[model samples]
Target: MGGGGTAYLTGYEAAFINPANLAVPDKSTRFSIGIGTAAGFFAPVMSVGSASRQFQAYKNYLDAHQPEATAITASEKQLILDRNYPKGRSRSEHQHRMDLILGGIQWRQGDRAFSLTARTRFSTRTEVGRGWYDETFEDLDSSTSVRDMSLFQQSQFLHEFSFGYGQTFDFVSGLIPRVGKLYIGIAPKFILGGSYLDLQYDARYWFTDEMDQPLFTRSFSYRSTGNFSGATRHYTANGDPSAAVQRHFPSSFQQDFSDYTTPTGMGGGLDFGLVYVLTLGDDLSLAHSGNTQPIEKSLRLGFSVTDLGFVSYNENPRSLDHARDTTLTPFAAASGQKYEGSPGQYLSFFDEVPDLNPFQFNQVGRSDDSPERPFKAVLPTSFNAGMLLQVNRLKLAADLTLGLNDSAFNNTKLIAHFGMEFAPVKPVPIRLGAQVATDSPTLWSLGTGIVMKHWELSAGAQFLSPRGSPALNLSGAAVGGLTFHF
Candidate 1:
């Protein structure tokens, strides 16, 4: 469901999502290849007003007046409470993010496959829990309530390059109604990536511009692993961090974009998958997992793991080396990051290091020595299992995806999806799916593919809906280019 393609992908597309499918093509040309890009944003905050109305209002006002001079009236704010601010109490769970993936490509032939891809992702989340809402939005007071509230946020931008190769093999497995060969594939990948910037902040007090309204952090910490040539210093909320900024880093720190990466390096990754195909009736046909291609297939099962590795940045990137308390504190990954947790546990940016040290005032300040030596940042890993039931032109698939760790450049938590693709017109097909995760599940998703005489084309979103009640809260998309089937 949603973007979970581990089990159902075929041909050229299999190179990335699950290369195991490369060896077993559906009823199509033996060889295939394609490329495309997809980007999206997802957040828990929902809008209370119609997006169309707001867009039209802004268009009309801009046409008649100037945006720099006009302020929304009380009525306008009432019309769209969601756009004006947010709904419900601002909790630490409130998050906002944007991700981009370019040059997503794959090539497949026989039981062999290759994939090349480049990706860029960025995200920021600020959980404004309970009592902090009044302090954050309007009634600026931290003492009005007894609730211990904190507003904290973290953000990151990183890029990746991956080239992979995979091979599929089948073995006799008597698990089915009759003796069958089980298909399994593994892809070893080479990857190169680095972080441009990383940031974290927390609120100690609240106020508006009318007051001193200083934008000072109550308890915050920061570290930069980019190409910043200036002196690297770790800062905590206790001291005047800005003062240390002038003393440590150079003003040119922001001027040079070349030094944005702290620990840039190359690493390796792996993708592994297994598929068991079953023949239904009629002429016995061994079909690809969840595909109708095999002669006659009733059921298919698939299991796969993606992005299972880390990039070791050989250079010692700058890390915040501030002194802190001894209490075991946990830092969370950005909203969409992965981590080791049962149902509720997760690793975040804070988990970037195994140390549970929290930044403290008297303990930490700018330092020349760094604790972070040449280290490896784990890539986001996804473990997924799916099943497909197929008959004729219809195929249904269900997938369960679990994030291995939240420390990767991009991350996600436990999610489930249900999707189906049926060729209403023979080889031409349409797909619909849903994300059934507990946090922000999207109600709908869609995709379509056209099989021409020589090739096939496909595109669609994981799921999307305007911000509002009952709106689809899904994120991500996978649009394809051309898969010239040979």
Candidate 2:
């Protein structure tokens, strides 16, 4: 519910969300074993409609049916001239992330817990720049005045090996317990970098002409880092950046992680969090709470910092930068494989630069330009503050998560989540929640869980316009998991 598990979570979930929860003591079992997964996509759309309608738009993109030149309008050209999100909205987002965890076992005793988990994470973001619009609707512009544009995109896929430990404190000799109890926990993880790519490009032109390519000058800077374990020579030794991408890229999660043997990249990070639970009743003693279920806390406050490390890739990575004014043939395959659009359509950049052109360098193992050296890529660090109020069999929670850096790839949103969990019956519980960001709002959520003795199953989803709200903010994603307490 609203991603709020900072106070008293158990098992492997606490290792990532808030490790402090692992130390809160569990009434379920001393040892737990389970496996779970969560996947979702978010896009700030121009219109708010049903899921089927939004998916239709995506399907149209996959089909690649460009509009005829005569069908273009003046208003559409102006929209393309502006650079920004899906439809030039200054602060918007379109991202897809998935996490699959093969959870093992966790043991808890007294106020300590130890756990082990393996997770494969995949996430990527694309900014709908003006150049992107030009790619899809280049035929609309029948000009020769030389319009300049740029595009940037980056994505990462990795596996994490995490070991966690957590502890709780009632009262210390030096630090008296103003609150009922204090819990602290940490999870140190070893990250294995599977593959990553960052591409940026700039084009100076007006329209598409094929023979001269609409009279344009272009430059591209690309990096294919951290995927050399089972390398293949996709492109020739001539070092043509366009030739390198002649193959189609199928977007899907690769289930086989056995190729992660050779450590092309190595990084270590830890999650640190602490929660203070405040008692409201006279019998809410920290010492006696060990025997009680859920610690009998009325209010809990927590703060956590996560993903605090970077990965250094020393594997053979290909870094290619090329620029030319001469027209080059578009890539094509006999097996019905072709680029979605023009050569520049798939290119995207992270920031605005004056020019992205660089001299081409051969992708040799010993080449100084594309040498086999370690390059550090920072993690998406985040800070979270949350409060949970428990009364009887109901819990009310509010959470605020802030991006440590403005451009951090994940959890970098200034959003607020409000949720409530009610257990009418001891074996079943229901949850409802809502979340909103400054750039977009009206994201509501709903879910439920069933606890049958030693087994637990839950599923949930967050929506942008599930109710067909005229003003849609974000779209796509469903989250669910299954776990056993024995």
List the global CA lDDT of all models.
0.49, 0.56
- Candidate 2 ranges beyond 4 A from true positions: 26-28, 44-92, 130-150, 170-174, 177-179, 200-222, 226-248, 251-264, 282-285, 289-292, 320-368, 406-408, 411-413, 465-480
Worst 10 residues of 2 by lDDT: 331-340
- In angstroms, give how far residue 262 of model 1 lies from its true place: 11
Deviation (Å) of 252 in candidate 1: 20
Listed in order, each prediction's TM-score against the native is 0.65, 0.71
lDDT of 2 by residue, 169-274 (tens): 5454127455467788899999987666555555544544544454445666555454321122333333333333323232223333343333567788888888
lDDT of 2: 0.56
Q: Write the per-residue lDDT of candidate 1 for residues 123-192, one digit (tens) a residue.
A: 5444443332232344445433222234344334456555655554543543445624456776666665
